[model samples]
Target: MPEQTPERTGQPVPEPTSNQVPRLVVTWLVVTVPLAYGLFQTIKSVVPLFTG
Candidate 1:
């Protein structure tokens, strides 16, 4: 038998489960927070160079 695709099966594409939300949020924060901090620190350091 051929494997059924969701289209053929007439099923909707599955959404991310509620259980995944927190994990995704944590993962996003983990990546973005450090990036944000680095960006902020870079801007802070660079501003002093321009202002002085």
Candidate 2:
């Protein structure tokens, strides 16, 4: 068991369950998919400008 500090109460931190794992994956994909697409499009546009 973990110890509690003065600022925090004696309550132990709750561990994530099995269902939360997929939620984390979905959350990351939601954030990362658009980020990856934007990066790809930006690089593609920049490459043409540099070459031409």
Candidate 3:
């Protein structure tokens, strides 16, 4: 076996700073909101067909 570096072994992961958290949260919310809305609309549309 060869010696391992941080990149090779994927150890010692870099931690995100406080500023990064909000950006990530905002990004996730922006993407997920649209996806969730689309899913909700699809389910609503399908449910009417099944019920009728």
* lDDT top scorer: 1
Candidate models: Cα lDDT each: 0.92, 0.87, 0.90
lDDT of model 1, residue 40: 97
Every model: Cα RMSD to truth: 6.0, 6.3, 7.6
15 Cα displacement, candidate 2 (Å): 4.3
Clashing pairs in 1: none
Lowest lDDT sum, 10 consecutive residues, model 1, at 7-16
lDDT of 2 by residue, 1-52 (tens): 7556543895676765988999999999999999999999999989978899
lDDT (tens digit, per residue) of candidate 3 on 1-52: 8778677898895765977989999999999999999999999989978899
Model 2: pairs clashing at backbone N, Cα or C within 3 Å? none
TM per candidate comes to 0.60, 0.62, 0.61
Q: Measured by C-alpha RMSD in angstroms, how accurate is candidate 2?
A: 6.3
lDDT of 1 by residue, 21-43 (tens): 99999999999999999999999
